[model samples]
Target: MKVGAIVTRIIRQMVRDKRSLALLLFAPLLILTLTWLVLDQESSDLKIATIDVPDSIITTLNDQQINVIDIDKPKSALKNSEIDAIIETAGNSLRITIDDSEPTNSQAIMMKIQQALVSKANVQQVEINHLYGLELSTTFDYVGPVLIGYFAFFFVFLVGGISFLREKSQGTMERLFATPIKSWEIVAGYIIGFGLFAIIQSFIVVLFAVYALGVPLEGSFWNVVLITLLLALAALTLGTLLSTFAKNEFQMMQFIPVVVVPQAFFSGLFNLENAPLWVEWIGNFMPMYYGAEALKEIMIKGNSIDAVVLEIAALIGFSLVFFVLNLGTLAGYRK
Candidate 1:
């Protein structure tokens, strides 16, 4: 019950972990900067593509400094996310085909296109069509996919990270290393085993959100599950790998701000694209950014696997990188 002895031990432990001390002090600020840069930046002008309209329409949009692209296959482009909206004519009727995956953006695009058409000539009427999402869909529907992925990653990361940290702190890692199991085998087994639970968690969370909470599930539920499971794999592998850096559960929690929070900020939950050139490039490295995009495409856009193949590949790539890194890091615990 010596007070001095307890205080000295605490100070010694904190001093012993130089990396954890640095992470605790600076990681929050770094995450805050990224989040603020993304969430605080103003949105850019909408991207517009003209289909079979007149030269005057494209000229008007280009004149407005809007991102205007003249494309031959407007429908394919919109589906492929090549363009935000298309300006066309249907039997002399002016029609605007919008990629309505984001309702707010769709509204803005519609307003801009209307202004463009009005400025051109006498606008009698205009037809509006949605390539994906409903004009009536709420913000909840738009961000629901991100929420689902965030929650899935959040819980899985905590469980996976803490579980591995416990094994390390409790000396089970060294005991397992004492056996003949290769590092990759241990890593693979952890992924395959914990991945089963992660998949089930994804299913429950998605089902509850869509069916119980009435969040819009415009696309196939299976697609949502696929993207979500991939996201979980990335989180699981990342958590286990990062555990190599943490000495205990508190240090593992330290990763939450740096690893999890930044991803949520850029995961399309908030559209902060003003500093797009660099900030958007930063988001490319986050695993959840890809998952959120894929989920939005499937849950709201009703897009299939082909439409979001790039995002899927990104998530898979993240998982693979973290998986390999986990193996490499695990070698430190054993050989």
Candidate 2:
């Protein structure tokens, strides 16, 4: 009888927590729906630029669902990732130069091109060259930079949100409110306190990724660190802002499914080339997407800071917006 009462009480407690109930009931379904929306898209619509190629080859490529465009110079297109591969006639042989940053996509394009060339009896030899990534580069190498940024963002968000929630729950925030300290000052103090650790965390993760894991560092090490730090700051500010809506640590965790998971899907980890235009647009709002793009440009393409200044600006913008929101949320608590 006592055990039955205990079980009933626990069930009543769970039922009272509407957010927890909703998360349990709907989070998995939401994630699955997002996965379907992402993975259920059609195969990659690879674009290949051709120069002096026969009409038969172009026809074959089109039949394989690859877009074939004629270009006078393939170098610029390949460099910009505007086209996946460049095909041109070299005497009796064929020359194919591919952007190998995405090894999986590169391999798939090569396979399709080879299948198309198989039908051409006059084609003698096929010479393949890579524009960026090494010939031996694996899928991990392509995704490694993105993973580093994601981890840095994830940990900082989790820690910062929970820490700020602790300050509120422990009455520390109320004590601060009783003082002459401004809301913005309190927010800035918390940011500076947490941001120091975030910087250390970013450096450790980036260094480990490049040196221990052997992830290629094509650009300056400091550039990667700068991007990681900015991403962490964005995460930190966002976390503290969201914590204002949570009453406790468990409530803080509820934001993960609603906030963090969606960003992961849209953060360039998966190939969304064939997804709907709106699906791609969702990524533009995600800070991690810009961070991933910048990291890939520097780490894979060896591009300098000037090339990724726009992405850096986007990260800074996200941080500033979140910082302002934090200040606004704190206003309600001010005495």
Candidate 3:
């Protein structure tokens, strides 16, 4: 009887919380819908170039599911990323030069090209070459940068957001307002204060993942740290800003599926270019998209600061926008 009564009371409380009940019923469906909408599309075209190739080889490539584009210069095309890869024939030798920016795409390109060459029943002349990273680099290396950003953002957003959310619950915000603290001071204080801890956390996570955990680290440690820190900042600001709209801690967590998880799906965790058009456009709005792209360029493509400057700029822009929005939102507390 006691156990039955406890269960009955729990059920009554759950029914009273309509948002929680709706979320329990609808969050999963919403996630499934967004997932199907984004992932239930055909892949985008993969462009390959054939240079000085025999007619038989060209015919074979054309028959495959890839796009064969004419390139005036194969070397320049591979270097410029104009083509995914190039299959070239010189005398009796056939060689492939792959643009290995995204390691997963590189693997797909190689497998398909190899199968095409083998189907001809003559592949003695076939050879493989990579434009960047090691030929032996694994999928882990390719996704290492993204995982780093996601993990850092994941932990910090929860801790920082929840810590602030507690202020509202414990009447800390009201207490603070009774003092002389300006609204902007409250906002800036939280940001700058958490920022110090976030930087340390970013350094530790990046170093641990790269050195201790054996993730691929082709870029300078400093560059990886820089990108991860910016990602953390974006997470911190975004989480804090969104926390204002959440009435309680549970609502704060609801942001995970709505805000964070969607970004993970669209942030190069899968092939961004392969998703539906509207879904791919969503990637442009995600802060994680730029961070993941920057990490890939730095770690796999071996790009420098200049090459990834645009992504860094986007991250900073996200941080600034969120910070300003927080200020505006907090103005409600003042007025």
Candidate 4:
């Protein structure tokens, strides 16, 4: 066929297949817009509640566009979330309460408050308490396990999805279908193979974060293993389910920007303190959020088994849902 005729034929085919065309062009845009709305929600200028403050400090804050809420009950202001941080200035000492959930914003607010205090006089070291940590902590200390969980989950998802797609394209899946074996049996076989590898991957990641990266490991090692294994199962189930939607390796890759990146943002790797409520709610739907939360609890907070059972339960529950969907998606192959 001539080049122009071939091109015309291709356009006709694409026009006829509206679903593929939309997946190629519009899905990314839709996801991008949602992510933008999630991340760009405007934060009110730092809300500061004070018991007593020098006129100089007050003027400096106003110049910085800080919303100063003069209040007697500093506790009530924080409890109500009316203020982002509190600065109680009594005598030469200043007591600061930083929410610490939004570490970046909280740090900025704390720094500005400190500078305001120093400008007033030779301030002795101020008493600072992070409502989250109660003491100074490293960012890696906070997010290291999360990063580990994410990297492990991301790689496993991609690998499993692409491998399953390969099986479909190579006719291997069809060959197996011709046999007496059941659809769920095929899924179970893949799981048994991938599950062992996933366990190894989780172990290496956890060990690297703890020993090499110096990430804290305060909880029971067994709890960490249990959570990681469950998280790996979730990734494996999601990968297999998504493979049914992807016709090829390239299409399998297309799932990442839509399915994977959002999890990272809402997975507690980045603080979602100021994120839109809808976006934050979306996190509750993603398996990574629970996995990372469980990891953080075990690694950083040193939470006990009782503390993380719900997170573990939720992760397992999500995996089971995906597993059922994975089986249902294979039903078309059944005789």
Alpha-carbon TM-score of each model against the true structure = 0.63, 0.65, 0.65, 0.64
Candidate 2 lDDT over residue span 1-335, tens digit each: 33343335434543675664344333433433344344333336788998888888899889877888766667898999888899888987778999999666787787788867766677765554568746323455667788778777877788778867887999988886786667777667667766666667677777777776666789999999999999989998999999999999999999998988888787778989999999999999999999999999998889999999999999999999999989988896673
Candidate 1 has its poorest 10 consecutive residues by lDDT at 24-33
Alpha-carbon lDDT of model 1:
0.75
TM-score of 1: 0.63
C-alpha displacement of 218 in model 4, angstroms? Answer: 1.4
Pairwise lDDT winner, candidates 1 and 4: 1
What would the per-residue lDDT of candidate 3 be over residues 77-111, giving only the tens digit for each residue? 78888778888787888878888986656877877
Considering TM-score, where higher is better, how would the candidates rank from best to worst? 2, 3, 4, 1
Q: At residue 44, give the lDDT of candidate 3.
A: 43
Off by over 4 Å in 3: 1-124
The number of clashing residue pairs in model 3 is: 0
Q: Against the correct fold, how does model 4 do in TM-score?
A: 0.64
Clashes of 1: 0
Worst 10 residues of 3 by lDDT: 24-33
**Candidate 3 TM-score to native:** 0.65
Over the stretch 1-335, how does candidate 4's per-residue lDDT look in tens digits?
Answer: 23333235434554676764444334433443343345433344778887676666778777766778777677876877767888768666767887777756686686677656555555665654554452224455666667667766777687667767887888877876787767777777666656665776677666655665556788877778778778878888999899988888999999999998889988897778998899899889999999999998887788898988889889989999998999998996564
Which predicted model would earn the best lDDT? 2
Error of 2 at 305 (Å): 0.2
Candidate 2, residue 232: Cα displacement in angstroms equals 0.2
